[model samples]
Target: MDATDGRLEAATVRARVATRENIARMNRSERAASALWPVPLAFGLAAILVARVTAVIDSRDALGIRGEFLIRDPDTALQLASVVASGMLVFLGIVFSTTLVAIQLAGSQYSPRAVRIFLRLRLTKVALGVFVATFVFAVAVLGEIRTKSGSDFTPTASLTVLVLLMVATVVTFLVFASGTARLLRIQYLVERIADEARPVFRDAFTRAQEVQADRPAPATATRVCTNRSPGVLDAVDVADLADAAAAAEGWIDVVAPVGGYVATGAPLAVVHGGGGGGGGDDRDGDQDVAIRRCFLLSNERTMLEDPAFGLRQLVDVAIRGLSPAVNDPTTAVQVIDRITDLLGGIADRPDPPEWYVDAAGTARVRMRGDTFDDLLRLGYVEIIRYGAGAPQVVRRLHAAFGSLSALGDARHHASIAAMGALLDAAVADAMPAPFSDLSGHPDPRGLG
Candidate 1:
């Protein structure tokens, strides 16, 4: 049965990989967005360069600069010289930008919206502004030249060419700037929405993944594991579950594997990974059995849904579950990821017409899925029940209270006390049955 169960668990776990893969695919969209800034940047630099070279040529002739000269008037020469200098600066700026972009895209950390921000500075427009201003100033100088000599300077084909170039540069600049700004605004709005709703989505993804793993597979057998020790049931702690999850590889999400007492023979911990000989070793058959049974029993026993605990232990567990492996504790990235997942599930709960309120003054108990109850039973939840009277008490409370942003604003003990009052007396009075009562004493069972 143990072997059969392990195989079944393995197969059940296989089913979830596809969903996980899908989410991963979504991540690619994010990467594509981050990669989109270089286009505008390239155009802006090219325009700046053209304007610079024209200015430098005109400057040399007017200022008596030694370099090869073309335009005769001081003003015309200076404007052309200025354009050349500006172009060189613009070229350097682009090179620097390219390097920075390469670094950021290599890791793909920034979101698409953030990339849009980088592109929306209106650099092209700014460049156009300078060109327009310079051209207007040149026209004034041309008027002065004609007034002093009482003769008009005929506009040559070269002057006409220069004017056309300037017009083209400004127009291109505005077009690029307008497009980038519009795109950036859209991306920013999307990002804000994603941020607001991220917790809920993340939790859903993780939960769905877990369900897919636990689903039954006829090819393998399954068993329940319980902590049957006579004395205190030193069952695995929440810390252990977190530790196991954290210790696993990034792609291989670890979840509680089984439920019930070690049912004579059960696997406690299960590993979800690419089965192509790339998975971690179980160490030994005994260790594998013990770990698998422990996970099953723990998840089965724990109760994770309790409104009173929505801001407390439940949130803590949710954060821990989604958190990165303990080895990567330098950042809270994983915790944030898991929090997003937890919130998503809470938000998506179907609307309930009535809130459950028991005599204990605690919210009424609304049952969640069997998996939630099974986990609660495994000692995973200190208290498990729905917030009756308000089906979405947690969500509502968070909305009113401003979420974790001001979670500390409310009195912690006060909420706990109120919760204690809400628990149904009858259920509260019931004591947990001893492990020994369920399974006969110390026979040859090796679980202990």
Candidate 2:
């Protein structure tokens, strides 16, 4: 079946079962009442049928009443029997239908439109039946009550009362249907496609810009941290901009805050004036743009596709096409990038089973007992986790190396070269692309 049909059938079946269960749980009085319902309905129908047949026979004068017995007119008897039977049927239908509706409303996938439509269709059928019955009864009443006084006749009070009852029933039906229709329409809209109210992200940036604009000068600082996404071209470009700004001007507008993560293609800083500050500009203008770019880039696009590409790989990609034109092209840059990728792969490959956030809030993968300590002593944490790849013999390489920032600044060419060679082989094994071969002529004017 189609989705809509499947849903409707499932819902109806669920409602029916639940209603039956509820009936089973009812009190003794309720159970007795429920049991009595069908008996009256069946009796009513049988009485109606017998009365109809008796009426025809008596109206034709085929059945004669014996002497000493009350002579009952068949027409009157038939009318009364029909009304009783119909009323009983209507009452039972309403009770059962109402219970069913209530059950459907309680279940999951309770579409008010579906409920309303069903109710409306059934109610409409009932209205038609009531209308026809009322018309027939009105005609019969008029015929039976009519009296001629010199060719003029007036409706009896009873006839007037019957007409009023019909009007009231019609009015009630119309009012109920209208209210239900409106309610269902509202419920349908709410269930299907209501928009959630929330603030737009752009407003926050606009407000920040407004605040900066109001001030004569805004405090700015540039600190480079790891980049988070290495895949997107835009992120690499932004990183290139930040690096050039930092190298040329001794600072960048935006840099990774310590312990903060950078996403791919996100701008490193927010320049205050215009889209970008002018070349050969003063420190104030450059710093403003750089700092603003930093904020702008802070909200890196979340990598839903690749959760493993974190801050370190992002920095590597940004610095991937670093200038061969510079005096000291840090091999450490290439080495660190490749090593980070390799170690990140290894760390990500094995499931930790259970891990915890350290005091610094960095996620530390758990090991069974002192395996983690042994790995640290072997400099495996730096190699496998951070991809630092410093010498294993140097106990407490972390303390000796200091922070990533300090480690980047260390004057040890021997360890750096060794790390670079080892990282090259590891990276080759892990990645499709080799890091040493990644070098190419970068675009002039920091375009790369």
Candidate 3:
């Protein structure tokens, strides 16, 4: 390539593609907290530091007769510290083995998307942190053991703290084991997934209900295209983008969906009203920088703003269960219970706002949102397609539709009725006429 083209390509590669949705948030990984090592590493560092202070404290005679402390003799104390250090290595092995097994079981029993749930547990991380911390603290305490003036000296206080930490790690391991076992259950996984999605839906609904400015699209517009790599359009910082538009005396039309993936060099947004800044001015440049800063990208879509993703996961689990290899219809029934609860809340606010405005109530960005019908279809269509033959799944879906019908929002009625019609047709396709009638009954437990 020519030198000029090479320089241009180099510049493009150096350009910032996207900004983080929130710097302080931890949903930046394949799983929560990203890696398991950071927490354990932090704990290990703290253990070394604490071991020094504890050693110094135990060296003095102030802590209620150092001789009567946990262990007194230097040789015996070293042996005990050695035991703890060695034993903790075993504990670490067990933790890793158990965690891997649990993760495998969850992935095989449920959807692969559900595997992240095990990694997201706070207790599991804490257990690992405590295990590594205890091991490091014990190793540090060994250094404090020595013989002075013919008598062996022991860091009694450090030993005592190490013992307590060892106990905590044991307790944590037991609880982690139990939590992992429970996580394998389909009901728990789907319920937790649905619970996480509810607040996202409510936030989206509340934002949509709020009034926005009635600004018009400008005759002449500057289309802001992506200058770097691609990622999921996680969250659009609307208020900030609107402020950028106002600074340039322009309005923007955001040509992206919040949860969809954007391709490289795609249109990020279109700056309308000419930014009111003269050509080649700093104000126009400032608006471009602000727009770039506002589009937060993530490695994976999170529960922060993407409401449909949760339903997508739940539907994934249900449909997989209904597959011929699994053929576990009751699992889908449990998922239907969760879906019904979410749909009930969604029915209350079926339409989310497409326009976003600045503090002064001027429209600056226009982005599209899924309609009620879209979500309903997303939540039900695949399940209906795979689960039609199962009476339990069909009954539970019918029950879900009937419950959604009671919601006050008249807008949801049409979608609910349409899905009910689709469910009935799917049932007809699955079974002969007279027997298919049996699946029409709405049973909360499907059979019960």
Candidate 4:
């Protein structure tokens, strides 16, 4: 391959790796497992090493006068260690079962997406690790106890370590219980989701100086890249797509929006001006594959690439609260408060550029990203539609719009005013009696 071709190939490889890493990082289950599983494994191995070393030292009388620090009876030490290990194993089972039950209950009682918050909790993972580690430590020490005529030995140091582990496990269990209780509160869940989503919104919408204005692709574009798998378009590696387009001397117009689903054979991206070739040709075929790799498809939406997914989660909670089965208007109002904060953050930032340009100042890729208006709609419209009959929900939503409008962005004001009109209409239609009082007025405090 020529130097230019080699450069493009290298760039594509880097892009592919980065894309996979991004997806893995966004996957909550994979992240939790990666972080939580190694704790027990490492602890188990460490326990065995410590046990063997302590056994050797005790047998050799290496401590000499310090032998007084060792537990006097090997048999008693072994029995106690075994009991602690077995008891810890049982406790580990209980903690695991309780955590799973909590997750299941949270999923059923609240939005399923909110369950990710629990999965990502650090305290729970640490508590689990401590329990497993304590059990492993005790078992390892127990194995070192020898009762033979000439081989009787006590792993004094190992026993000491086991005692420490037991204490740590107890403390961790208490903290875990307390944290879980706090997490179960609805207010905590709402705040947690908002906290996680704020930085994502900022990152997704942050303007890049290198991004050029979007240029329309040529009408004669013959090469259309289709998705081979059907799933949500989680993210697009725009830089990689741009590199590939630059290499092929073409521009790629992204057809599918981020967070939207694309079916197999649907147009994922349209490549303009890359000369057409038969399917078997390596040059065109490789370029097609390169472009396809830039679009990361997944079974579900992720906050890493789709800021709207966060809004969707919050909205789901609100809508569920508004449902006839759970008419918790207070919860719905709290959700709106968070939604307003997210929307306000979006309104304050400049729109992220849709077009990516290569170093030569040519636009190589066009991406489909969510706009502030799109977020506004996603954040409020569904909740309003579901809660139209509830005066409290309507009032809170009106106050949210007023707060968003106060940010002084004309576009934001316009979107909020339009939504306010819709809510007014919906409320009038749903509860005609309240229409006279709730009509078109900006209530910053919502009926206070």
Best model number under TM-score: 3
lDDT of 1 by residue, 1-448 (tens): 2356355223322222111112223334433333434444554455445445544544443443423234545456446534644653564364346435633542233233233334333443344344443344334334322223544332232243455655655565556456444533423323333343344333322434222223222323222222232221112332333332223321221222211234332323334321222123432443233233322122122111122122232333322322334222211222223333343343323222111222222221111222222212221122223221111222222232233223322323243233334433312333233432322121211122
Q: Could you give candidate 4's per-residue lDDT for residues 1-448 as a string of tens digits?
A: 2245345222221001111234434455444443556655666676667667866776676766323645668788888898898889888887788778778977887888877777777777777777877887787777778877787777666677788887888888888888888888898888988988999898777654543333544546457777778998877777777788888888888999888899987888878877653263334477788887787787766676788888999999998899899888788888888989888887876566666676566777777578898888999898879888877788788788877888747756777789988988888777767464763454544455
Judge candidate 3 at residue 329 and give its lDDT: 88
Candidate 4 Cα deviation (angstroms), residue 264: 2.4
lDDT of 2 by residue, 1-448 (tens): 2245345222111000000112122223222332423443443354344444544443453544312122123344335434633553564465456436543642213223233233323344444344444444444433432224443322233233344545755574575457444433423322211111001111111112111011112225323223334323112122333343333333223333222354554433433223334343333345344333322222222211112222332233223222233211232233333333333222312222122222222222111111212211233223322332222211122222222223332323344345444544554454343322332112111112
Going through the candidates in order, what is the number of backbone clashes in each? 71, 18, 0, 0
Candidate number of the best lDDT: 3
| Candidate 1 least-lDDT 10 residues | 439-448
Off by over 4 Å in 3: 1-32, 147-151, 207-209, 275-286
Task: State the lDDT of candidate 3 residue by residue for 1-448, as single tens digits.
Answer: 2245345222111111112245234344434454677778888888889987887787775576577775677788888889999999998998889888878877887877777677777777788889899999988887888866676787777878988997898788889888877877778889889978999878766633265345454346564545245888777777677677777677677887777787766667877765533244333454576677777666666666688888888988998888899889888888888888887887876477666666666666666666777888999999899988888788888888988888738877887899999988888888776667888899888987
**Per-residue lDDT of 240 in model 3:** 71
Q: Each model's TM-score, in the order given?
A: 0.27, 0.19, 0.88, 0.86
- The CA lDDT of each predicted structure is 0.32, 0.31, 0.75, 0.75
- Against the true structure, candidate 4 has what lDDT? 0.75
For model 1, the superposed segments whose C-alpha errors exceed 4 Å read 1-37, 44-78, 84-214, 218-276, 279-448
Query: For candidate 2, what is the TM-score?
Result: 0.19
Q: Would you list the rank order by lDDT, best first? A: 3, 4, 1, 2
TM-score of 1: 0.27
